[model samples]
Target: MEGCKRLEQLPKSIGSLSCLTNLNLSHCDRLANLQIHILEQPSPLESGLQRRKIIVHLPGEINKLSSLVNLSIDGRIHIQLLNLIGDAEHISCIPKQQTPDELLLSRCYVLKSLNIKRTRYNKDGSSFSCISFSDFHSLTELKLINLNILTIPDDIGQLQSLEKLDLSGNDFKSLPTSMTNLSRLKYARLSNCIKLVALPELTQLQTLKLSGCSNLRSLLNLSHAFHERVRYGLLELGLDNCRNFKSLSYQVRQLTSLIHLDLSRHDFEEIPESIRELSSLGTLCLNNCKKIKSVKDLPESLKHLYAHGCDSLENVSLSSNHSIEKLDLSHCFGMKQDEHLITQILNDGFSQVVCFLNNYSLVN
Candidate 1:
């Protein structure tokens, strides 16, 4: 009964419909109780409780829906009690927990995608044991963000059908080596995982984002995973604000197909000379890289270069026949002081370039 704004509850007798395959209770703002109805469900193939503002509890009786195939409970409402069951293909829930209990996920045998976001931290430091993910054979995408997860089981690699994984804002120090076995995994985002110290070789990934992982010290495994034959598959890599990661130069030379690279907030004094090897690189971000004094040895394929807020930048060398379409050196104090540097930049065969210098811009 969707759009039933005043519907307060489902009758307990309604559960007797053994063949009930679909139940949609969307936009039911006053409906608050489903404990009795859910506990008696003999068989339900689909159930949706969307936009129910007063429904905050999903009692353990939901596990009784043995034949349920698809379940979706969406809205801005926060769930106070969560119970997972059935052979559902897709599941999404936001639960307030001290420690996210992965053991509850063991029952989703045929699940395809799961996203669980923890809304609070555990003050008592109590948590359930991690369960093996090997049973989720049909699972393709999994996102468990900000759950204070220290690690995951090795059986995670057994998810042969998995493609995308996002564990951003978690507390993982490292990942299991078995993750490399996911041949079809294309995207992985670990942004803001401040405690993450390392990662396994996931060469099959086309996009890897690690924007705020400050403790990470090396990326040798990621680089070593690629060779001349397969390196061209990786298209995007983000390492912005990864302060201690210094193994960028040599490893980047291998990603011949990289189109976008973010090196913002790094302490490097110069752009890696090996960057010129990225023949497919189009966008390069060096914003707030204050230590870099000169810009040179750029890739000929670079279309956009962002070095804004680079206060120490003084000299910039661009080839006469280069393919650069835009260059941003805004807020570079050193460049504004050197009149010769400014004059040299204007005469560097940039007749068709759009350049941003200090507070002004030049579009020739």
Candidate 2:
């Protein structure tokens, strides 16, 4: 029911809707207990709305509903509904998302997406050493953000249908090799996982973001993951501030399928000659790469080139046929160029590129 604000408790007869596919108990603030009748009787609850602030303690009986497919328990209040529902079928209430015994996941075989984000472990309690995942093979998107788990179960690889996986802000040092088994995975976000050092090869992955994985060196050597992307033809790659990256694979030249590459604040002193081989390269970011000395030999497909903080950059190569859309070189005080060249590009009827060269010295 949409406006069931005062619906304190669902009656046993309410579970009699056998064919009921979607259940909207979002505003049922007074609902406290999840009875078995809700799981076994009226009908299999298909679409569950969990916006209710007072509907806490979803019963362990939820496991009995084989037809239950989608469950959205967003906010801390709805999350409390889970805390009381431990793996134990006898639990009268749902436990916190980080239950001492979160063993019921295996029962949800048809669940398409399981997003259990943000957890608080009991300070004085040390319970389950592992969260079970052997049963979530059908999950298409699995997001376990900020769980603070030290390790992810290797069974995560079993999600053969998974398309997106976000494991940001965790303490894990490395990913299990089983993660490579996600054959259908397209997007993977591991940002701010400061302790993460190693990653598995994702062959079908299209977008791989590892923005703040600064400590990856302690877990694995650098850039082995990049080689995996090169082999698999990744399209969008973000390695911003990956502290340990000093060199790129020679095979990086082979990444002809790359579209967007973000290397801002990285340690590479010079642009790789192999980068010119990326015929599909669209955006190349080298912002704050202070040691870079030159900017030249870009691929024909480049649309945006950002090298703003390259203070040592003294030379740049540009031709009239270039297709650059935006070029940022504002801090390159060392570069000496003819004023006419910049003027021609800015005033040319055929030029659509926006250039920023604030500190450049104009020569005759």
Candidate 3:
């Protein structure tokens, strides 16, 4: 019930209460195991189809909830419940220690939402097949964090109802072409997937994040027709740390509805003139882009600009229509303390501009 910290196991007879629907066993830090089984076979006189349904909260015993509809587990413990019966509406598992095979989740047909974080395999350099979710046609949100997974299964396109998918902090080198068919997908995060070389075409995607994917060399061959379909719904795009990309301003200008753009830590030498076309751009972060020499042609819709650590930038030319509220230029070694630049920035009516000069003064 409450604060059962030392609880190590559940009583087998606990299943006798066939009508029990809610169970809260959270914060039982010392709990390590649990066993479950059906109790008291249903009699013919029972009114409804006699089935077990429950909600459980434990550290590493989720496998015991074979009839669970909602389950939450703690730490980074792997789970294996492929043949589970009930249709779980929500399931959260923070894997502690185990391989992908140990996570045997192949047959959860009615599962709707699955979240996993910090799941690592038992040994380094070990590979595993992607968990198939074709049976979970009702799934909506899926998250996988720090899994160290090398590849995503090609069959993932089958989940037509999936709305959000996050695959951050993995080792995937590429995605299957089937990803383009996810028409209902709205939000996607692929941050820190350093080895990811390319992306599958995302036609109906609204939010796309590729932050810290250093090896990502190019955007897939997305044409103008594809851009038009995503313009209104696409809101955020992150290409931070994609150093190999030669030019993105031309490609990015197509997303007229883009609100946030991050291109930090790259090899770009100049902000292209085409950047002024993003009339809806709100937030832009260009930190650590050392080759950039100046800031020019920024859109008036820009609200936040982060140019910190750009040691090669010599000047910043802000337009009179600038609406920037927050500007960060810390550690910009090449930018001299010019009174005109400060006066111009203030005259632009910005609320806050952090300029950490070498002289140790906050120029706002």
Tens-place lDDT digits, model 3, residues 1-364: 6367667666767656656555566555455554444343442335765534455544334332333443454321223334221222223632223334534653334445777555432224333335665545667887766667777877789888789999887788998889888889999999888888888768578789988887887664556434554344678888888876644655675677778888888777787577788898898888999999988889999888888899998888778878877777778889888677677776665457554554444445
Residues 301-337, model 1: lDDT tens digits = 8888999999888878776556777888889887854
Per-residue CA lDDT of model 2 for 1-32, tens digit only, reads 64454554556564344444344554443454
RMSD of 2: 11.5
State model 2's lDDT: 0.61
TM-score of 1: 0.68
C-alpha TM-score for every candidate:
0.68, 0.65, 0.70
Instruction: Show how many residue pairs clash in every candidate, following the order shown.
Output: 1, 17, 5
Worst 10 residues of 1 by lDDT: 82-91
lDDT of 3: 0.67
Q: What C-alpha lDDT, on a 0 to 100 scale, does residue 29 get in candidate 3?
A: 44
Model 1, residue 160: what's the lDDT? 86
After superposing candidate 1 on the true structure, give the runs of residues whose Cα lies further than 4 Å from its correct spot: 1-109, 118-130, 222-232, 337-353
Best by TM-score: 3
